[model samples]
Target chain A: MEKLRLGALEAGGTKMVCAIGDENGTIYEQVSIPTTTPKETIPKMIAYFRDKGIDALGIACFGPIELDRDSEKYGYITTTPKLAWRDCDIVGQMQEALHCPVGFDTDVNGSVLGEVTFGQAQGKKCVMYLTIGTGVGGGIYSNGELHHGMLHPETGHVLITKRTADTYAGRCPYHKNCLEGLAAGPAIEERWGRKAVDLADCPEVWELEADYIAQALTGYVMTVSPEMIILGGGVMHQEQLFPLIRKKLKEYINGYIVTDELADMEHYVVPASLHDDQGIMGCLELARRALENDH
Target chain B: MEKLRLGALEAGGTKMVCAIGDENGTIYEQVSIPTTTPKETIPKMIAYFRDKGIDALGIACFGPIELDRDSEKYGYITTTPKLAWRDCDIVGQMQEALHCPVGFDTDVNGSVLGEVTFGQAQGKKCVMYLTIGTGVGGGIYSNGELHHGMLHPETGHVLITKRTADTYAGRCPYHKNCLEGLAAGPAIEERWGRKAVDLADCPEVWELEADYIAQALTGYVMTVSPEMIILGGGVMHQEQLFPLIRKKLKEYINGYIVTDELADMEHYVVPASLHDDQGIMGCLELARRALENDH
Candidate 1:
């Protein structure tokens, strides 16, 4: 089979990364555009790939993006924090402009797919990916497919135990102290009055941050029982948070359920290996799958 | 295809419920045997099923049972608090004695499968079944198959926030404040100085108990995003606990992820429609699957 040119887009809250890749996920051309509004951003993304001769486009977008194929708004970005993109039919617009098949999913889901296809989670049956950036979100690859049900796995919105000493009230608009509210990048900045990167030396900051993340990870471990949990995004860049999270996970789970993966904590929970390219590569994989299915 | 006779067993901590059924999960005859030492109990179960012309046997036993087929201890009950049956090779023994294909999983998983196949969750793609009996065990049917990884989901041990006024350390031997520790029948008994049945009228007791359950269910809903959650077991029999749980679920989730199921409340979270027969009938379905797979 001839290798087909593919288009990949990693649409974030701040910017959109548009790339021309191939069936093998190798990028041939890529560009970034500021996410001013759907009207402006979607057109720029489509124009970048218009002459790329791609057979299909795959989007790993900041969501809640509608992925339900049966819905009329299936390819539209639904109620997201990025107010400008809400209700924007990014996939439909791209398909109309490029006249090619398109695939769409949450950015976190794309990351997990990227890891499963090309990074640390390769060959793993049950894999989980979590991004703790401006917000907390997770993607699950379970039973050899990206898991989706009524919605998606809303790991960030799940409640977590609040630390008794800290009373900062969380930053999330919805659940005040949910995993996202307490542990996301903005949550840390708001709680401690500084960005996570600047607070690396403060044990108090990372300790509480790690505590919240570990608490949420414990929930993931117990419920999803993923073979590996990959943590990424801005906050996880703090190297010390990993050990604290590993320790807290052990403390929380308390050996009630045992597995070699849990015992070897180092392998069970680790930072994402794909780095920033996960979303783009994952989008390429999704595009590959779409084309393969079409065939 | 000729219908095959199937044998189903629900091995509980106190007693073993044994039944002879068919592929359709219809019981031809059923009996109960007290759970004793494996030497005595295994022989009695074997004696009952012998010469029954069963094509397959499914054992939905009290666990933590090893379910990984590649492991040396695949069918053995491992490290269960039920000391008499710990490390017992229930499925291997059954297969050896009956000379037929054997299916084995946690009793909770069996119940979920039963519900999916023959009860309330029929035709549903994503479903969760939780048993809050002597212990708080759960099973998930996600993406249209029973979910299992590492070990099957030990959801009972996931941590929950302790209520402010409740000081009792909880009854679980491991993880003192876990979901099972706080909301299991024994947990309620230990916390309130009475069994769940005896404390039926205690609003405070039921309210706190319902709060912990709802918290755990919130985690389940967030992670699994199941179409339905079925609550079963002795603790759920309080009946009043259901409304309290539904109310608390709405509180914890707080509309972060919108779904029609969450809005309805009553339809999304429900009691097991199969009631007491869920585990046995689930075992029968497992037996049926085992026979079907053999073909």
Candidate 2:
């Protein structure tokens, strides 16, 4: 079968990217729309691919969204800080307008699917895609599928051992010592009084950041045992973090897992190859998968 | 087409229990044999099952054992402290003698499969069987299968935050402050200068144990999001750890997951219902699956 034209939506807290793509990951056109109210946002997204002739639509939306298909509230973003879009049925509305099968998942899940399908994690079986931006989140893809149990992985909220001599007190609302609170982009800015981009040359900043990320990765690797771990999001833009995280992760693991891949961190820990496009491309993959499922 | 008689082996470090059972988890007969040299141990297990007329065999062995079906050392137990059994191809040896299909997995995986098949986690889609015993370990049953990626989940070795004011330098060789190091049976005995059974009267002991267990569960819950978490092993036998772990897990999670189930600790975190039979029962399930696959 030939590749079908698919619609992809990358829904962030601040903005939404709507694109017309295909199973081949070809983005025909993409338009960014400001996320105001659902009333404002829905119409703009509908307007983008109104007659794009899509076979399916995939929404890689910022969560906690209802991804459970059995639930009536599936595709509804719930309890988000974005009050205007809370409980909004983004997938339902898109499916209603576009009359196409829609695949709905968290942004991080989409990023992982993107990596496995077209980015850094291509050809890998079990993989972890961790994005350390304003928040820390992870997506796990294993055996040709995104893992969703009671809920998709809420990796950002898991607790971590605090780095000594570094007491930022953390900023995550739920857990004070959570990975997101301790090591995310906001945490970095909150601790250093400067954003991650601005602190690119600071050795202490990257080392502390690397230590925390490595700590989180330590838990992730031991529990999930993903073959490859792909780091993305805004904070990972610092090239220095890769090497630092690699060394620290090895030290944290301490030869617990005897494998050649763990020894060679250069290949094991890598930057996202798709970068900013991971979410949207992942949305495209979701759309493609949804279309395939429909058939 | 009827249920086939299966041979089940629960190969622990100190001893091995071999049983004959069926798909319905019925054990026709069982025998316990002391674990000595592989040469002695192999023949004893074979002698016990030789005239059993089994259709398939399953072994739930201790680690670190090679489980990857694609690896050349797939059935060989590797890098184990049990010097006599190290590099022993238990599965291969059994299959050669029995002339039947064989299923191999870690003891924890077998335990979770046991729980999912016949114990507390029965009828659940995603479940975690965690054993806090001589050593800490967990087996994940998701979508009706034991979770095995690059390797099985090494939940015990994952780093966790130290409980306040309780400073017992952890004993896990891999990581300093790991789940096993903080909460396992040996760790508890080491910290309190008495076994968990003897320390039952001491409020401080179980409180600290519960705190560490709850902390580990927080990471597991946030990451795996299993519908049910069944507690097993000797440390979990204390009985007092149950309510404390349930309450502490809720506190650790702290409304991060909004669900009625999270509120009801009575049902969420539970003791293993199959008790000592979980591993042998799980091996029957493994054998059943293996027999089914043979067709």
Candidate 3:
């Protein structure tokens, strides 16, 4: 029996990762390249994956994508903050280069799929995955499936509570005090006038960061009520931020709606089991699932 | 062949409705009563349904309820804004009074189910039902099932942009500037010094109200990306608000997401099809579904 082979791409705002893997999410080969111009970068990705002997490919990318079921332009990356990649025909380009079926979706959705298939949310019916890096992106899983509609969920931009005395004019281009503006890594750096990693030891910065995260999580808890919430991204590396965020979430949520799961706060909010490789692994899983359905 | 008899109860903060219906969602008999003491109100509701000879009972009430699969207290009303209904044994009381298998869920969830089964969202996969009454509440349906997890979705409390410059302390005791605090009927009355019904003709009030609502819907659009959004509630009687809200949503969303459904503003944001009877009809539908699943 020939082993099922899959190619995975984790496309971020600043970088792109190309990898070849199998059904088990085991990467046999991988490469990371800086994201500059799509015209310059996509060719290198195609060159790298050309000889991988992959049967299928998946791209986990930032959106908004043209995923309308009725539209002729479905599976095209429509608009993105990454200026060089706007209106980029990612799926078409990948299909032309590889001559194989290409599966594409938002990076967060891919991560949720990866988690549900092989990570913490294995048996869960509903889960929420939040990646807090340059920006806060979220993926929701409802009834064992990725939550998809006309477009993907841009939960990072949901509006959140603002402090009265603290007047930090948030960094998000969209809505000034939205969750991404208040809790994202860039927001932390802007509010304190230093990089988040530089202030890892600073008590005041952590306190404020934890407060903003707790507020955002409070809204998520009230709005989606996921069985489990998986927190990832560069900011979570601090490790110390988790306990403070969990503490503050309990304080903010109150006991208005009590449950045994929430009563044990330590068990509810948890770090991603797959760590940094979740996006790439998720893409591979997406490809496998799509290929299975196609046959 | 005997016709299936279904009992339905629409339990709101201020009122309670009991009805008998069939699988087709046609009500044969119904009763409306003030939401006074739960003991008094629940007994009256049970008496009404019992007198009509219902085979199964569905109670769609304000939540948070115990919906967990393994919980012994499943279907009980846990917490609600209605002071008299807090910690009330709603399912137990009704089951004892009527001597029938009971189905219970949030009123908003019931409304969404009704829309999915018999109204506008009949075949849609992802739908959102938002009610803008004394307070704003919403129900989310994803992948053909009502979205529920830890407790339930409290979308009304999600924070929104504070558009006005004046100092208007929000009405909600929980989160001051949350969506309900800024845009609910009480919020409108407090800001304009008159009831929303009284200010329907005032362009200034509607514009401000539209601003707040559009801000909230912008967040909703970004977070959920529902196929169709159904709006209902007492305050929505001012039909003029819909167009104003749709225009503002386009401005706020800013074309980050491109969808044919949303591109035509007038068609995407629509009013509920069931009008005043949606809640009661939804509860009846819920009861019928539960009965069908039991077999």
Candidate 4:
């Protein structure tokens, strides 16, 4: 029996990471490319995977990707913050360049898949993965499958509860006072007039950030009811936010549904175990699933 | 082939309705009982179903119910506003009394299932069903299945983005200013010092209600990104609120994600097709599904 060889790609707004891995997600080779125009970035990505000699490829990209159930253009990147990638044939380009079967989904979805298959949420029937980075993104898994619908889940843009005394107009172009507008990286930068990293030492910023996040999590808990909520991405790297989020969730939940797990606090809300590799590993897992279905 | 015999129960805070139906959700016989203590109500419900010769029963009840997957007490009504039914073994009682299989879930979940199976969301993979009654409740459907998790999705209790200059303490015990606290029927009554029906003649109340609802819906849209949203329940009887909510949604969403479906405001956000029967019929559908799985 031969081991499954797969290629994984995590395409974000700022960078692209490509890796070659076995079925178990053991990366043999990898490369990172700063995101540029599709013409330049796509070619470089193709070149990296081409020399890797893999059998299948997967992509986890920032989206609103056009997903058609019956069409080969299923995984094409349709809309993205990256100016050059809008309406670009991402899956088609990869298939044409790499000459292999390809699987694709949003980075959050891929990250969730990776977690479900090999990380924190492994063996969990239902889970939600949220990445709070340049922007907020989320993926939901129910009954052991990634939730896909008319479009991907975009939880980050949800509205946040505003405090009476605080008045920040918000930074999201789409929604002036939505969660992203109030708490995303750009929103924090605009509100504080400094980068998030610079404010890591500021207790007030983290306190406010945790409040917004905990409020959003309350909504997610009330709506999705996932057994575990895996929080990831650059913003979540701030270790202090975790305890504050849990405390706020407890205060907000109000003992409505008492669970021994949530009573423990450590069990209900936790950080993503895979860290950064979850997306790429999830891509590889998707590629494997796609290949299995094909055969 | 024997036609599957199914029973449906729609358990509202104020009333309990039981109906016998076929696989197509056509009601054969129906009965209504005022919601009272569980000990008093359970026996009447059991006798009614037993006399009707039901093969299986489905229950759609208000939450927060204890849906512990690992416990036999999964569908017990844990904490509901109906104080008389607290800590009651809802599903177990039904199953024991009637001597048949049972399917149990939240009323909102049943409503979404009804919409997905027989209403406006017939062909859609993801749909959100929101019932604005004494309190606001929502059921999320993704990939043709109702979403369930740690407990159940309690979307109504989620906090909302405060929009108005007026400061009225919300009614919800969990979050004083949550969406349900601010926009539910009781909230309207509390805010205006009159019943929602009495205030229907006043456009000022409806305008504020619409603003709050639109803010909550905006959060829902950004978080869930469902293909279609179906609004139902008693408060929605005021047809004027629909247009107000739609207009507010457009104003809140801006033009971030351009979809022709959403571009046409009238088509995307609309009323639920089944009206009051959604919950009962959905319970019938759930019963049918449980019977199929049993076989």
Candidate 5:
């Protein structure tokens, strides 16, 4: 019997990572397409997978993407800040071209699903994965599935109190000091006048960054209370931010709810083990699940 | 078959509401017991239901209550601020005395479950029920089930930016300016020189209170994205606070994600139609589910 082949697309703002893989998420073929417009990018993805004869396709899309499987606009990417991609029906186009089952979800949800299925949060009943990139977003995997509701969880937009020492108005046009507005890569750049990659060694930058991240994580801890929180994305590469975030999480939690996991923060809050591959791997997992649900 | 009788106990810091009801949550008999020591209160509850011959029991407890059924201490209420009730195994005691299957959960969760089952949130797939009493807390009922994870949601502790005009340190022992600390009844009294009940007529007092609540609800909206939000508890009784919170919720959202639900704010955020009986009725629902799940 032949192993099941799956097409995975990790679509982002800057680039689209396209891959053809097996059920195990091992990439047999891969391609990277720089994001220009829907016309240029979606075709590249469709062309790559069209002849691959993959059983199904999974798309981890930069959203707010529609996920209601029954809606007429279910697969459409609606209301994105990226003007060119607004209301783009990436799923519909792909399905129309390739004629296969397509799984669609936010990039963060896919990332978390990847982590849960094959990475850090494997076998955990409750888990959270956060990406602190140009913006902060998270995916909640609870009870062995990605948690989705009215819209997908907009964890990035959750409002967080501004730090006493920091006075920069947040970069988010919506909520001025929300977690993303305060702690995301763009917000950090705006506040420190340097990109997060350049300011990796600056203690003061990480201290405040960690402060905001810690506060946001504390909110997640209190609200979602996931057993494990996996942190990833561009800014998290700064190794110095981890301990600071862990320490502040402890102080902010204040032992109101005592747990051995809280005491040993290292075991609970962790960096994503899959790193860059999480997107494609998660997409593969999404594809597999979509196929399974079809049966 | 005979109608199944279930006993429900809505235990709070102030009082205990014990009731016997049917599977439809119709109360046949009810009793109110003033909250005191475990020795005083638990027995009163035991005696009330001991002879009632209930097939199953449910406890809607003011927590943090242990919900993990497999743990040795699964039914214990751990780490409550109420000194007399700390670490009380309310579920175990009642189960031992009454010899019936017992369902247990936080009071807010019970209320939301009740609301979803038979009250205002009926037919709503995603809903949130919030109690803004001495301490603000909430329950998320998403996709027709009570949302639970590593632990129940500690929504009260979600951090919110304090209103610039309000200078009072929050009342929560942990995270001084958390939603509860900034917006709870105690916080209201401490911020202004009067309790929420007394300050009902003060437009300025409710304005700040509404500001903080709106910010918190905005966070919940961005994170949970519930279809309908049912606001209960003592502070919410101030009828003027509703429109102010709805208006601020709209402003905080900033039209980033457009929903018709957001346009009609008055219908989205509503008072708890069940008012105070949500707890015992929710417990009744819990008991009925427990009995059903047993098979």
Candidate 6:
């Protein structure tokens, strides 16, 4: 199993990052392909994996994927803003071309799986990975598996209470002042009239940002009860946000769940240790799991 | 399995309802014992099961009971309000005396398991059972099992936004305006200066109650993505609240998740069909499962 070859694809709207890896999370070969259309993009993927001669492929795809394993459209990416890829049969095409088992899930779920398998959440049974960049999306990993139900958790859209001092009209078109609208990087820029990286010097700006992230974490904590929570993406580069979010998370939790993880804020909620490698590494794990489950 | 005799105990603060049943959820003998102290109460349970000749036992106990089966205090009723039974070893004593595989869980969790196995949520893969009673508590059953991470889900204590139209200060001493504080039976009684049963005629009261329940349900739906949601408990007895909650849940979800279950509100959000038998029936299923898992 450790020596088995796996193909990892971090499928995105802009591009796809493909890597030939192993069950042990080592990447042997990698390539990036531009995403144009199904015809243009999928052939490039098939060519990459075919050349690699992989045992299995794992796709950390940009979704609204049909995650229901029993669904006829199980591998089709439905209703994505990437109009060209909408309703595209990504997994089916890859599986047919590569002639191997394929595991597919949302990118965020992949990142969490990566973290859980080999990164920050190494030994944790229950964990959540949240990416707060242009949008707020998250993945749930619990009982040594990624969560997929009606769909992978639409975490960003969960409604949250807004602060009294904030007057900014939230940017999310769907639900205004939702966790994503109030806390994501774009929300920070819209709220402070400056980018999050630039607004770091202003202490109050981060305080509010941490407040929203913490509130969202509280909801996730109550629902998923993750053993550890990892925060990633561009906005978390501030470093100051880590302590602030952890503190506010404990405050919001209000001592209901009395455990070492909840009491010790310093280590419970932290940054994604894999840095930029979370997706590719997670995809590799997914590939490994798909191969194992297939057999 | 259907021929095996099982013991079901609905352990409450005021009384303990013990029943001798089988895998088919048929109760042959039953009795109510006053919950005075372990000395008086537990012997009655042992006596009941000893005579019944059961193969397994299930205790649907009032909690903060130790749900963590691996912990040293696995079956101890920890920090309960019933003064004498704070740390009562209910499961341990029952297992020792009756000498059968004893299953134990919180009453709410048991009710949900009951629904999932033999009642409303039968054949459903993912479901949430929320009881908006003296307090708003819930149980989650997904992937054909009860969810117990960190602890069973403490659904009632979650934070929700205050509706702009209402200005009632919430009653929960822990979190001021959490779901339990805002929408529980006591909250309604406090707000209207009457019991829930007395206030059923007021259409607006039920509307507001439905709105708050809908808000909490929205959070659950987003996180759990349950296939069906069952509403039970005393406050839900107000039959008018069902249609109102279903309508409001759809409105709050706002078509974010497109599914047959979400589209059909009438059949999706429903009342418990088993009526007063939810606890005992769930316990029977629990006993049956414990025996199966044990073997």
Task: Provide DockQ values for all models, in the order shown.
Answer: 0.77, 0.79, 0.52, 0.66, 0.68, 0.63
Candidate 1 lDDT, A68-169, residue by residue in tens: 777888989888867877799988888889898888888999999989998888888899999998888999998777888778888888888898898889
lDDT of each: 0.87, 0.88, 0.81, 0.82, 0.85, 0.84
**Top lDDT prediction, candidate number:** 2
- Minimum summed lDDT over a 10-residue window in model 2 chain A is located at A256-265
In candidate 5 chain A, what residue range of length 10 has the lowest lDDT sum?
A: A255-264
Candidate 1 lDDT over B1-295, as tens digits, reads 7777999999988899999988776889999999989999999999999989998998898888888888999999998887878899999888999999888888999999999999988988889999888888899988767888788998998889897788998877767678988888988888777767888888998899889999999998888898889999989888998999999999888777787678888988899997579899999998888877788
Q: Relative to the unseen true structure, what is the Cα RMSD of model 2?
A: 1.3
TM-scores of chain A, one for each prediction: 0.97, 0.97, 0.95, 0.95, 0.97, 0.96
Can you tell me which runs of candidate 6 are displaced by over 4 Å? none
User: Which CAPRI category fits model 2?
Assistant: medium
Backbone clashes in model 6, listed as residue pairs:
none
Most accurate candidate by DockQ? 2
First chain of candidate 6, TM-score: 0.96
Instruction: State candidate 4's TM-score.
Output: 0.95
- Using TM-score, give the best candidate's number: 2
Expressed as tens digits, the lDDT of each residue in B140-255 for candidate 4 is: 88876787776677788777766567587888887866778888888888888987887778998888888888877776776677778888877888899999999988887776
* Candidate 3 error regions (>4 Å): A1-4, A33-56, A93-101, A164-168, A187-193, B1-5, B34-44, B50-57, B81-84, B87-89, B92-102, B161-164, B187-194, B201-204
Q: What's the true lDDT of residue A229 in model 3?
A: 83
Ranking by TM-score: 2, 1, 6, 5, 4, 3
- What does candidate 2's lDDT look like per residue over A1-295, in tens digits? 8778989999988899999888777788989999889998899899888888888999998988887777899989988888988899988998999899999899999999998998878887789889899888889887788887788899988898886688789998889789999888988998999867889889999999899889888888888889999898889889899999999999999888987679778999998887478889999999989988999
Clashing pairs in 2: none
Model 5 — TM-score against the truth?
Answer: 0.96
lDDT of 5 by residue, B1-295 (tens): 6899999889888999999998786899999999999999889889899999899998888988888776777989888878888988888898889888899889999999898887977887778888998888888887656777778889988877876767787778778778888888888888787767888778888888888888778877777778888899988889998999999888888887576567789988999887577878999998988888887
**Which scores greater on lDDT, model 2 or model 3?**
2
Pull out the clashing pairs in model 5. none
Report the lDDT of model 6 for residue B42: 94
lDDT tens digits, residue span B1-295, model 2: 6878999999999899999999888888899999989998899999989998999998999998888888899999998878888899888999999999899899999999988887778778788888888898888888767888788888988788896598799888778899988788888888888767988899989888888889888998888888888888888878998999999998888888876557678999998887589999999999988888888
- Rate residue B180 of model 1 by lDDT: 87
